[model samples]
Target: MGIEIEVVYALPDEQVVIPVNVEPAATIQDAIRLSGILERFPEIVLEDRMVGIFGRCMALDHPVQAHDRVEIYRPLHASPADARRMRAEARRRRRAGK
Candidate 1:
Protein backbone atom coordinates (compact mmCIF):
# COMPACT_ATOMS: atom_id res chain seq x y z
CA MET A 1 0.00 0.00 0.00
CA GLY A 2 1.06 3.59 -0.64
CA ILE A 3 0.47 6.85 1.12
CA GLU A 4 -2.45 8.79 -0.28
CA ILE A 5 -2.44 12.59 -0.28
CA GLU A 6 -4.22 15.55 -1.79
CA VAL A 7 -2.53 17.78 -4.34
CA VAL A 8 -3.81 21.21 -5.26
CA TYR A 9 -2.70 23.30 -8.19
CA ALA A 10 -3.70 26.92 -8.34
CA LEU A 11 -3.94 27.99 -11.94
CA PRO A 12 -4.53 31.45 -13.29
CA ASP A 13 -8.22 31.49 -12.59
CA GLU A 14 -9.05 28.06 -11.28
CA GLN A 15 -7.87 25.39 -8.94
CA VAL A 16 -7.18 21.76 -9.84
CA VAL A 17 -7.39 19.32 -7.03
CA ILE A 18 -6.07 15.80 -7.43
CA PRO A 19 -5.59 12.81 -5.23
CA VAL A 20 -2.18 11.22 -5.35
CA ASN A 21 -0.82 8.03 -3.92
CA VAL A 22 2.89 7.81 -3.46
CA GLU A 23 5.32 5.97 -1.32
CA PRO A 24 6.17 7.54 2.00
CA ALA A 25 9.05 10.03 1.90
CA ALA A 26 8.32 10.95 -1.67
CA THR A 27 9.61 14.32 -2.81
CA ILE A 28 7.38 17.17 -3.99
CA GLN A 29 8.82 16.94 -7.48
CA ASP A 30 8.29 13.23 -7.52
CA ALA A 31 4.66 13.67 -6.70
CA ILE A 32 4.23 16.36 -9.32
CA ARG A 33 5.82 14.19 -12.00
CA LEU A 34 3.67 11.24 -10.99
CA SER A 35 0.46 13.26 -10.95
CA GLY A 36 0.76 13.89 -14.71
CA ILE A 37 0.46 17.67 -14.30
CA LEU A 38 3.82 18.04 -15.98
CA GLU A 39 2.43 16.73 -19.21
CA ARG A 40 -0.46 19.17 -18.97
CA PHE A 41 1.65 22.23 -18.13
CA PRO A 42 5.06 22.19 -19.68
CA GLU A 43 5.65 25.70 -18.39
CA ILE A 44 6.09 24.30 -14.91
CA VAL A 45 9.11 22.33 -16.04
CA LEU A 46 11.38 25.11 -14.83
CA GLU A 47 13.15 24.72 -11.49
CA ASP A 48 12.74 28.38 -10.55
CA ARG A 49 9.13 27.79 -9.58
CA MET A 50 8.64 26.74 -6.00
CA VAL A 51 6.87 23.74 -4.53
CA GLY A 52 5.16 23.48 -1.18
CA ILE A 53 3.32 21.12 1.07
CA PHE A 54 0.27 22.27 3.00
CA GLY A 55 0.77 25.95 2.20
CA ARG A 56 4.33 26.01 3.49
CA CYS A 57 7.07 26.49 0.94
CA MET A 58 9.28 23.48 0.76
CA ALA A 59 12.17 22.14 -1.22
CA LEU A 60 11.60 19.90 -4.21
CA ASP A 61 13.02 16.94 -2.38
CA HIS A 62 11.06 17.55 0.78
CA PRO A 63 9.50 14.37 2.12
CA VAL A 64 5.79 14.07 1.82
CA GLN A 65 3.61 12.78 4.59
CA ALA A 66 0.33 10.95 4.39
CA HIS A 67 -2.57 13.32 3.68
CA ASP A 68 -0.22 16.15 2.82
CA ARG A 69 -1.41 18.79 0.45
CA VAL A 70 1.23 19.12 -2.21
CA GLU A 71 1.30 22.35 -4.11
CA ILE A 72 3.32 23.33 -7.19
CA TYR A 73 3.82 27.04 -7.25
CA ARG A 74 3.95 29.24 -10.31
CA PRO A 75 6.72 31.67 -11.02
CA LEU A 76 6.16 35.25 -9.92
CA HIS A 77 5.43 37.69 -12.69
CA ALA A 78 7.76 40.15 -11.01
CA SER A 79 9.98 40.28 -7.96
CA PRO A 80 8.53 41.56 -4.69
CA ALA A 81 10.53 44.75 -4.81
CA ASP A 82 9.46 45.38 -8.36
CA ALA A 83 5.83 44.68 -7.57
CA ARG A 84 5.90 47.11 -4.66
CA ARG A 85 7.52 49.77 -6.75
CA MET A 86 4.92 49.29 -9.44
CA ARG A 87 2.14 49.59 -6.92
CA ALA A 88 3.65 52.76 -5.52
CA GLU A 89 4.00 54.17 -9.00
CA ALA A 90 0.39 53.41 -9.74
CA ARG A 91 -0.66 55.16 -6.55
CA ARG A 92 1.46 58.15 -7.42
CA ARG A 93 -0.13 58.31 -10.83
CA ARG A 94 -3.58 58.11 -9.32
CA ARG A 95 -2.79 60.87 -6.87
CA ALA A 96 -1.36 63.03 -9.63
CA GLY A 97 -4.50 62.56 -11.67
CA LYS A 98 -6.74 63.39 -8.75
Candidate 2:
Protein backbone atom coordinates (compact mmCIF):
# COMPACT_ATOMS: atom_id res chain seq x y z
CA MET A 1 0.00 0.00 0.00
CA GLY A 2 1.03 3.60 -0.59
CA ILE A 3 1.62 6.09 2.18
CA GLU A 4 0.69 9.75 2.08
CA ILE A 5 3.39 12.33 2.76
CA GLU A 6 4.25 15.95 2.19
CA VAL A 7 7.51 17.28 0.89
CA VAL A 8 8.58 20.83 1.58
CA TYR A 9 11.29 23.28 0.68
CA ALA A 10 11.51 26.87 1.81
CA LEU A 11 13.17 29.91 0.33
CA PRO A 12 13.64 33.34 1.81
CA ASP A 13 10.50 34.59 0.07
CA GLU A 14 8.57 31.44 -0.67
CA GLN A 15 7.80 27.90 0.44
CA VAL A 16 6.72 24.93 -1.62
CA VAL A 17 4.81 22.04 -0.18
CA ILE A 18 3.84 19.10 -2.28
CA PRO A 19 1.76 16.12 -1.32
CA VAL A 20 2.93 12.75 -2.51
CA ASN A 21 2.16 9.08 -2.16
CA VAL A 22 4.72 6.34 -2.06
CA GLU A 23 5.07 2.68 -1.32
CA PRO A 24 5.09 1.76 2.35
CA ALA A 25 8.73 0.71 2.05
CA ALA A 26 9.76 3.98 0.46
CA THR A 27 12.55 6.05 1.92
CA ILE A 28 12.74 9.83 2.34
CA GLN A 29 14.68 10.03 -0.89
CA ASP A 30 12.02 8.05 -2.67
CA ALA A 31 9.24 10.29 -1.46
CA ILE A 32 11.19 13.38 -2.44
CA ARG A 33 11.73 12.05 -5.92
CA LEU A 34 8.06 11.12 -6.27
CA SER A 35 7.08 14.55 -5.08
CA GLY A 36 8.77 16.16 -8.11
CA ILE A 37 10.34 18.72 -5.82
CA LEU A 38 13.75 18.33 -7.39
CA GLU A 39 12.39 19.08 -10.82
CA ARG A 40 10.59 22.15 -9.55
CA PHE A 41 13.63 23.34 -7.68
CA PRO A 42 16.63 22.55 -9.82
CA GLU A 43 19.00 24.17 -7.36
CA ILE A 44 18.37 21.37 -4.89
CA VAL A 45 21.11 18.77 -5.04
CA LEU A 46 20.33 15.86 -2.74
CA GLU A 47 23.95 14.89 -2.25
CA ASP A 48 24.84 18.43 -1.17
CA ARG A 49 21.80 19.02 1.03
CA MET A 50 20.15 17.42 4.03
CA VAL A 51 16.77 15.73 4.40
CA GLY A 52 14.58 15.32 7.43
CA ILE A 53 11.21 14.34 8.80
CA PHE A 54 9.15 16.84 10.77
CA GLY A 55 12.19 19.07 11.34
CA ARG A 56 14.44 16.26 12.64
CA CYS A 57 17.39 15.55 10.43
CA MET A 58 17.50 12.10 8.90
CA ALA A 59 19.32 10.23 6.20
CA LEU A 60 17.88 10.07 2.71
CA ASP A 61 17.67 6.35 3.16
CA HIS A 62 15.50 6.72 6.23
CA PRO A 63 12.18 4.95 5.78
CA VAL A 64 9.14 7.14 5.48
CA GLN A 65 5.89 6.77 7.36
CA ALA A 66 2.38 7.87 6.53
CA HIS A 67 1.66 11.54 7.27
CA ASP A 68 5.38 12.30 7.43
CA ARG A 69 6.46 15.76 6.38
CA VAL A 70 9.66 15.34 4.44
CA GLU A 71 11.73 18.46 4.51
CA ILE A 72 14.71 19.38 2.38
CA TYR A 73 17.12 21.62 4.24
CA ARG A 74 19.26 24.31 2.74
CA PRO A 75 22.85 24.66 3.80
CA LEU A 76 23.31 27.18 6.57
CA HIS A 77 25.28 30.25 5.57
CA ALA A 78 26.69 30.47 9.09
CA SER A 79 27.13 27.93 11.84
CA PRO A 80 25.07 28.34 15.00
CA ALA A 81 28.13 29.40 17.00
CA ASP A 82 29.14 31.96 14.40
CA ALA A 83 25.62 33.34 14.18
CA ARG A 84 25.37 33.68 17.94
CA ARG A 85 28.76 35.36 18.12
CA MET A 86 27.81 37.83 15.43
CA ARG A 87 24.56 38.67 17.14
CA ALA A 88 26.29 39.20 20.45
CA GLU A 89 28.90 41.44 18.85
CA ALA A 90 26.18 43.49 17.21
CA ARG A 91 24.34 43.87 20.48
CA ARG A 92 27.54 44.97 22.23
CA ARG A 93 28.26 47.56 19.55
CA ARG A 94 24.73 48.96 19.81
CA ARG A 95 24.93 49.14 23.59
CA ALA A 96 28.29 50.93 23.41
CA GLY A 97 26.83 53.52 21.02
CA LYS A 98 24.02 54.34 23.43
RMSD of each: 2.0, 1.2
TM-score of 1: 0.79
Residue pairs in candidate 1 whose N, alpha carbon or C atoms collide under 3 angstroms: none
- Colliding pairs, model 2: none
Q: What TM-score fits each model?
A: 0.79, 0.92
* Model 1 lDDT, residue 89, Cα: 99
The true-structure Cα RMSD of candidate 2 reads 1.2
What lDDT does candidate 2 reach at residue 97? 100
Model 2's lDDT to the true fold? 0.95
Q: What is the lDDT of residue 79 in candidate 2?
A: 100
**Candidate-wise lDDT, in order:** 0.85, 0.95
lDDT of 2 by residue, 1-98 (tens): 79899999999999999999999999999999999998989999998899899999999999999999999999999999999999999999999999
Model 1 superposed RMSD (Cα): 2.0
Q: Name the top TM-score candidate.
A: 2
- Total backbone collisions, model 1: 0
Runs in model 2 lying further than 4 Å from the true structure: none
Per-candidate clashes, comma-separated: 0, 0
